[model samples]
Target: MVSLIIFSILSLDTILNVPELKNAHYGICFLDLKNDSIIYDYNSEKLFVPASNMKIITTAASFYFLGKEFRYKTNFYLRGTIKDRKLYGDIILQGGGDPYFNLENLERFADKIISMGINEITGGLLIIDDYFTDERLPAGWSWHYLDAKYAPEISALSFNKNVVSVRMRPTNAGELANVYIYPSTGYVKLINRMTTTTNSENIIIYRKPEENTIIVDGMINIKNARDIDVAVKDPAMFAGEYLKERLNARNIKVSNPVARIRTYELFLRQKQPVLIDSVLSPNLLEIIKETNTESENLYAEILLKTLGAYRYKEGSFNAGLNAVKEFLNICRVDTQNISLWDGSGLSKHNLISPAVLIAVLKFIYNSNLYYDFYNSLPQPGKGTLKARFNGFSDTLRAKTGALQASSCLSGYIKINGQDYAFSMLFNNFVCPIKKIMQIQERIIRAFYEEMRRTNVDNTELLKPVEVIQQ
Candidate 1:
C-alpha cells in the first residue's frame, strides 16, 4: 500500500515535470477530505498569483459572514408631501450597494413612483451613493485594462453591472461597420472607425479615461456581428442618467437635472425624508453562486466592501481587506502565507499558497454552509469549467483562474465515493495558457486514475505518506 502511494506521488511528479512548465512557478496540494490528511503536496507552501481563483475565498467568507438569505435593499424616499399629483420636494434614491441593480429595476422604481400618485417632481432626483467610498478601482489593478467589462468601476449605485454592450455588424466589404449601443442612451459618444473585412474579425473597443467617449476600431468579418462589453467611467452617474431618462419616459417631469449628495448631506436637511419604496437584490447565496461560477470581479469586490460596511461602518478597500483577514483568522488559516490586495483576483498582487487554499476549502467543508459553498463552484460543462473534466462531470467541481502568465484551478474531486480537495497554482509561466491547462488536466487525470485503482481496503493508502516538497 505504501509503495502504491509512493508510485502515485512519483507519477504526479512525472506529469508535472514537463518542459513547458520547466520555467514556471507552480504548486499543488491534494487532500483526502474524509481522512483530514494531505494525500499529496508539492511546493504547496509557496505563494503564487491566484487570478480569479481568489473569488473562491471571497465567496466563502461572504457565505460565512453574511447569511445565505442576505439581500441588498435600495430605498426610495420622498422629501416633501405630494399634492394634486405633484411632488414639491426631491425624490431621493439611496443606494444600498446592490451590485445586480439593472435597468429592469429602474423600471420597477419608476412604476413604484407612479403608484405613489406622484406624477411630477418640482425638484431634481437626488442620488445618495455614500454607502461605499469613492474609490472606484481596487488597488494593484492593471490600468491598461480599465476599459474592459471585467474591470468596471465599483460603486454603491451600479446599474447593468456598470457596463454597456457595443454591438457592431459588418456592412459591405471595405465599408465601416454599423454600430449600436444597448439601452440606447445619450450618455456615451461613439467614434466608429471599424471597417468590414473579408477576413477574420478583429475588434477593439476603448473608453477614454475619465470620459464617456468610446472609440471602436479594427475590422469585422462580413459574416460576423460582434458584441463587446465596455466598462463605464462613473457608475453612479450612469445610473442616475438612466433613472432620469426612465422617469421622463414614464411622463414624470423633473424640474432639474439629477443631483448627487452624500449621506451626511441627506441627514443634514431640516425636513427628514419619508421612505416610499425599496428594491431588494437577490439573496446573497445567489450572488455568491454568480460570483464564483461566473468569476465576476464586480460582485466579489462589492461583497468585500459590503463586509467592511457591515462590520466596521466603512466600505473602503482597506476596511474590506481587514474584514477578509479577520475571516481568514476565524478559519484558522495562517495569515503569513497569504497576501490579498483585493477581493477579486483581478489585482496581480494577490498571492496564496496551495496549502492555504486547501485550508480554506477544508474549513468550509466542515462548516454548516459546506453544501452551499460547494454548489457555488463551477463544475464540468458549466460556467468557467465548461469543456473541462470531460469524463468526470458528476464527480468533479472547481474554479478556474487565468491571467497573463498565471493560471489556477482549485476545488473538489470525488473518486470511488471518497471526496478530495485540491488546488493547482501556476504563475510566471512562459508557455501558452492552453498548454498549462493541458498539464493541469493531465495531472488531475493521473490522480483520478490512481485513486480509482485503489479499493476500500486500500483507502488508507490515500493518507499522507510524505510531503514531496517543503
Candidate 2:
C-alpha cells in the first residue's frame, strides 16, 4: 500500500511539472494533513495581503475565544418613573455596538415596548452609542467606498449598519430622480439632488459614508422607478427618527423629548434605569457562518471588538491585537511577519506569508474545530466560490482572497476523494484581470489533477527550483 501511494505521488508530480504554471509569478503550498506531510510548495514563504481570506483567522479566533453560543445583546433601560403606564421620567436605549442591529430588530424591540402597556412617555428618550472606541477605519479602504454599501465605518450604536436604502426613480417626464427611502423616515437628509437621465435612470446606486454624510454619486438606470437603495450616515439617528414616528403613530405620546447621550450618566436621570427588555443577536456559530460565507465586514469588525472587550479585557484595538498575538503564541505559530490593522483584511497594511497561513490552517485543522472550520469554507461550485474551480465546486474547498493586483486562494481541497490543505496566493502580478483569473483557474486545476494521479513524491514535488542570476 505504501509503495503504491509513493508511485502514485511520483506520477502526479511529473504531471504537475509544467512550464507555464511553474513559472507563473505566484506562491503556493499544499500539505497532506492525513500524514502530516508537505505535498508541494513554491515561494510559499512570501508574504502577501490575504484580502477577505483574512476573515478566516478572525472568525477562528472569535470562535476560539467567544464560543459558539455567544450572542451580542442590546439592552433597554429605564432610569425614571412610569406614571399611569407612562414614562414619567427618562427612557434610555443603551447600545453596545452590535453590528447586526437592523430595522426589523429595532421595530420588534419597539413593538415590545408597545406590549408593555406604555402608551405615553412623560420623560425624555436618550440613546447611548459609545460602545466601541476605535476611531480608525480599516486602512487602504477607498474613500469612495464610504459611499458604497459595504465599506461604512464601524459604529457603536449602529442601526441597519447605519445604512438606509433610498430608491431613486426617474420622473415620468424622464428628467428628475425621485428619491424614496424604503423604510421612508422623515429624519434622513439627502445631500445630493440627483438628476436622472433616461439611459441612467434604471441603475441602482448604493451609497455608504466614511464620515457623517453619505452622498449618492452614481446614477440609477431604471426609469419611472419609484425608489432606489442608498446607505445613510447614522443608523441610530435614523432609527431614533423612525421610532419616534412609529410611537406617535401607535398613539404613544412623549412629553420629555428624544436624544442620544452617554450611558454613564444614566444615574443622573430623574428615574433610574429599569430593564425594560433585551434583544439577542444570532448565535456566534451563525455569525461565524456569515463571516466565512459572505466575508461580512460588519461581522468581522464586531468580532474584533468582542475580542477586545472580552478576551483582552481592554476595549480597544491594541487590546484586540494583544489578544490575537497571545492566541497565535499559544498555537505555536509565528507572529513576526503579520501586522494586523483590522480583523477584516480590508486594510492594505495587513500582511502574512503563504507559509504562515498554511501553518494557521493546519493548526485549525488539527484543533477541535477541524471539521467545522473546513465546512465553513465556500465550496467550489457554491457559495462565494461558485464561479471558482471552473464550476467544479464540489471537488475543491479553498478560501479565496482578492484585491487589486492581489488575488489569492487558500484552504483544504478534496481532490479525488483525498483531502489536501493548500494555500495559493498571487501578489503584485501585473497581469490583466481576465488573465489573472485564468491563471488562478489553471493553477487550481493543475494542482487538483496532479494530486489525483499516482507516483507523486511529496517532498520532491515541492523542492525549490534553482534560480539564475540576472
Q: Let me know the TM-score candidate 2 reaches against the reference structure.
A: 0.85
Please give the range of 10 consecutive residues that has the lowest summed lDDT in model 2: 1-10
> What is the alpha-carbon lDDT of model 1 when measured against the actual structure?
0.88
What TM-score does candidate 1 reach?
0.94
lDDT of 1 at 414: 88
Best by lDDT: 1
* Candidate 1: tens digits of C-alpha lDDT, residues 1-470: 14323213657777877898888999988888988866787778899999988988888888988899999989888887688999988888888999989988888888888898888999889898889999999999988999999999999998899999999999999999999888777787899999999998788889998899899999999999888899998888888888888888889998898888987777677878988788899999999999998899999999999988988889988898888888888878888768999999999899988887898899998889989889999988899988788987888889999999999999999899888999999999898999999999998998888888886643444444553331
RMSD values, in order shown: 2.9, 4.9
| Model 2 segments more than 4 A misplaced | 1-25, 134-136, 200-214, 217-231, 255-258, 268-270, 390-392, 455-470
1-470, model 2: which lDDT tens digit per residue?
A: 13212122333345445553444456677778777676666667677777877787787787788888888878877665556888767666767767787777767767877887898887666777666664535556667566555665566667777666766665545444666566767666555556666564435354434344334444445445544345566556666667677778788886755787876788774556788777778888888887777767777876787788787565566677667776777667678767777787777678877777777787888888777777777787766776767656666666777777777778887765566777877766665545666666776677766666654554544444444333
